[model samples]
Target: MDTWWLLAIPVIFGLGWIARGFDLKELLSESARLPRSYFNGLNFLLNEQPDRAIEAFIEVVKLDPETIELHFALGNLFRRRGEMERAIRLHRNLLERADLPVEFRDQALFALAQDYLRAGLLDRAESAFKSLADTPHADQAAGFLAEVYQLQSEWQLSIDALQRSGADTPAKSRTIAHLYCELAEAAIEHKDLKAARERLAQARAADAALLRIVQIEISIAAAEQAWARIVELADQTLAEHPEFAPQVVEAYIDAAQHVAFSAPGQRPLDTQLRSWFDASPNDALAAVIIKRLEAAGSMSAALEFARVALQRLPRLSQAHALLRLRAAMQGDGDEDLAHITQMMNGMLRSQKRHECRNCGFRAQRFFWQCPGCKQWDTLPYAASPVGP
Candidate 1:
């Protein structure tokens, strides 16, 4: 019995050794199934060497096309690194796979759309985002589609895309209004006053308090040579939107100049400007009044107005206007003084710009949408150098 027990223990030990060997072999086979580059890529990723990691992962993906997650990770990495061609190609390849799941296919399409957008291929991007409609990415895709249309200046299409988004937020409303306003401006440029008016009406309906709506209305009125309407609109703007007084006053000055020459019987713009200034006393209004006075050879009146404006606003433009009026009134006929004034005036004109309140983007003229940040109604109408 003792001898039989020793032999049984040896047999059991041999069986245990064979089982351990099988386990080790299975583990090795599993590890061997993954390409060496996969481990290297993981190491590179851990070490923060993205370039090397990308290279190593590309090898793994090339060797194993069945790696679905690897393909997605690699495609995203390419896109984020601005390698659009590679990202587009890889995502396109994923999409071409008939075996790809519906969710993955949608994801790949979205990624490809983003690639085209970043690459400035708007037409291709438009198509890709449009296909994503009604998918899980529908809402995001709709917003991106609107952006695509906006970049293409397809204002109506952008409005449609926004409508499809079905978002009722104030930002969306403002964007839609800006689109209508853009269309109105385009109509104005083509001398289609009727279309312009219709578009502005739509803009107002979208957002009554949007200052750009009033500004565009003034523009349309000016285009029609409806100087009285311009004045009326400006008066309304100053009354309702005192914060936008500078912008409204600037437009008023332009219309007032036209009225001065074209329609003399109309109430004098100068008289109206003075009245407005008396009521508001802002530097923007005061500067215009001073310029009108200077134009009429009322040098003393201009200087007096400048003195009061400087005391109130103390803005650089007002000080420059005051300097010019003082020089003209003193009759200093000094050539150097005149040259210095011209130089200072030129410097001020160059420096004075409509800076975007959102992004600080400066432009010589006003823009409803900030060129830098693309935000609507961000540029404030500050006073500019009064005269040439």
Candidate 2:
């Protein structure tokens, strides 16, 4: 037994020696495979010269194809520099390799999708992203796919893609609601009332407080000549989102003209609007209320309403409204009206009609999305607080 143990020790030592030699040989080969350009690439990266670094890395990969990581790094740098065609070519080369592992292949496919997206090749991007639907990049790929569909105005497909996005559930649901609202707007433009109604219902179900859905509903009611329904939606919007009160003012006046709203022996349109103005105290809604009073033949009340609002809000717009009303009362005052109009125009020249509450970007035109930040429902009209 003692002799057998001594013999086994040498045999085990011989096997360990062989394994060590093989490991050292593999390490030396990898070290010898690294070219001078690999060090140059590292130096360039340390110096923050990414373009030159990318070029050097590309050379390193050409000399030693074992460095699969260099290919991805090169492709990403090309995409970042707006060289979409180069990125697409490099990633495609990786995808064509039969020896690539599943993870590396998925990485290559994702890079190719991004390249196609950056190049505005929507169809190709969509196809590539769809191939990654069940991979680790599923949520991220869905996000990009949603953006592509949104750009193409394919609202239903956009909503479907967003449902699979990486954003939290509430945010994803909100964006889906916005997409539904977009579909509703398109339906309204084409005079498809049934489709518009169905889309609005879907939008409300997704996001009940989305003010654009209310706006579109009011617009649909206006088209159907359902004045009372318009008033109902406007009032509900005001009660829930007072910031959106300004957008509903004109709807009130339009509805009042078509119907006298009497709530079971209560005051009609003029009284209800006055109550709303008193509750919210908005300049735009005040203007609408005053107009409604004047239409009801209460000129004195209208002038008093403007005067009282001027004393409280003390805004240039309110003062302008007061002066215009007084000028109207004066039978022969073209001079006064002209002066008031000139001053109003000057004030409006510096005033932005729209503002993004999220980024504080101001513009003269309203947008459903903030042009500066590209965030949905961020822009609100400056004259009125309405949703994007």
Candidate 3:
């Protein structure tokens, strides 16, 4: 029995050696079967030369028409390089193949849709995205569809697409509310106040506490001459969201003045302005209050306010305000003050730019939506406390 066991072990070893030899030969044959361009493409890709790699891969695809994944890769490369027409053609060719796998067909369709989107063919892109419904790419398709609708200014369609996207998040809610706000603004433009109110109601329902909702409501009330409602909203904004005080201050003062004219006993504009400044002290608010006093012919009050503002914040803007106030009170013969004020004004112009909170894009005027990132409610007041 021992002799038989020794002979069986050598036999097993011999068979194993022969099997390994066959595997080695098979690997070598497969390596030889791949064209040289395939290796060249891989080398170029590894070296990060995408343009040369694309040419090499194109040769490989021509030599081997059945290389499905290479076609997809080439299509993606073309699209990324802004060659949308080439990508569209390649993906369309892939979809035309009767023997293509179901998964590859879906991928080809999605790729074609993206090509159309990037090419600015909105109608074709919308149709293609709609066709992807119930497929694995449906969620992504819905998002792209909404973007298309947004670019086209089809607010209702965009809202509908966003709802179908099923991404229930705070950002999505805000985007929907902004869409409703867009509709509201349009309604207001056409003098359809009733429709504007309805759209604003929908916007509030989407985001009950959005600051922009209150702002739009103020606008609607102003249009309707509802002075009392405007005053209330302005107060609510200042008390509840003090961080946005700068943007709302002018509107609040305007509404307050209107209310005071009608009722004759509403809080004085100067008092309300001073109260807001005390809560959220900034050079802009101080400037507004000073202007109000000057408008009322209270030169003494304006000079005092400007002096107090300069003491609190020793910025060039405050100095300029004080210089102007003193000149106005003392009969305007101070050439040095005028020259200094002019120099400060030149410097302040550059600093008085509103910046986007999301992307840091600066603009001379305020924007609800950032022009850089297309984000809504991103621009805060100018970083400087005082500017035109």
Candidate 4:
């Protein structure tokens, strides 16, 4: 009886080991079946059935907790749907796993950062993005950081982030210059002329062809009463960028007013204004020249300048200037002046101001960048008149 019991105990132990092996096989088969659910979820996603897809994916995640790809997919789907909290949860869960591979860990972190950004949690987003700044995703994160800084009006932080991220691409060079201009404008507003000058210099260095920087520099010189510097910069600016000459014509006139010339009888101002008027024939400049000539006791020269400008452009403003010069010279009464004024008003009604060629945005005031489309160097100086 003792020998029989010992033999039974050995057989019972062997059977128990076999049963445990079968249970292990069953678990393996169940886990293998989980991949089919994943495929089904992917197919549903491809068919644009998110509800059904999420159901299948959730089932798969329950069965196989280590599937990072499904988590990523679900996280991205939630983000696209604007369910940012859910997206953050899914990504945060993935990030918490110590067994996750390095690449997947980075991807989850990036997705989490995106969730924070979309949720307007900028502080959280900034922290999340800072971690990825030196990774493969650094460029995109840096760009987002720049935008965030801009939204916060933290110009210095934006500039610093852009510099760190290699922000100056060939396509974005103009934008970078504009960013510097914004900095300079803010500095000027705060009465920080030194800082403003530094920023303006940076802008010019970034894009020599940017005409707005030249305009700013001219204004700065005018404010400082640096007459010779103004003349030198204005002449260089006009020679380099004649398309913007009309905009800066007043500045040039102001600079000319400051310069002291020899020969008391010499009409130096008239000579300078006439040279510019002849070269450009711009209506705005011609008006300024007309006013200056009248002041210098050269009414005939002033009228001639207005006539030349009107003949060239046929603009209402130029014609008005011409009529005013004529009335002043002839000592006309209200009758003649009133008739010319009416005619000038009709011409003004017919004229259009500057238009943005890129976006078809029209405005009376010139913008270096189009407010409509935010495009740089898009607003043309010329107007598009209706019916010829």
Question: What is the lDDT ranking, best to worst?
Answer: 3, 1, 2, 4
142 in model 2: Cα distance from truth in Å? 2.8
Better of 2 and 3 by lDDT: 3
lDDT of 3 by residue, 155-266 (tens): 9999999998966999989989999999999998898999999999999989887787888888888888887898888877777666566777777777776665445555
Give the poorly placed runs of model 3, Cα more than 4 Å off.
1-67, 70-93, 96-99, 260-267, 281-284, 298-340, 343-352, 381-388
Q: Candidate 2: where are CA atoms >4 Å away? A: 1-65, 81-83, 96-98, 164-168, 261-353, 357-362, 371-374, 381-388
The models' CA-based lDDT, in order, is 0.82, 0.82, 0.84, 0.75
Who wins the TM-score comparison? 3
Q: Give the TM-score of candidate 4.
A: 0.57
- Name the best candidate (by lDDT): 3
Model 1 lDDT tens row, 1-388? 3577877998999999999999999999989899999999999999989999999999999899999899889988998898999999999999999999999999999989998998889999999999999799998899889989988889999999998885689988889999999999999899998999899989888877788888888888888788778877887777655657667787787776665434544456677676666665666677678877877888888888888887766666677777787677667676676676778778776774687887878887777788887777788765433333
Clash tally for model 4: 0
Q: Between prediction 2 and prediction 4, which has the larger lDDT? A: 2
TM-score of each: 0.71, 0.69, 0.74, 0.57
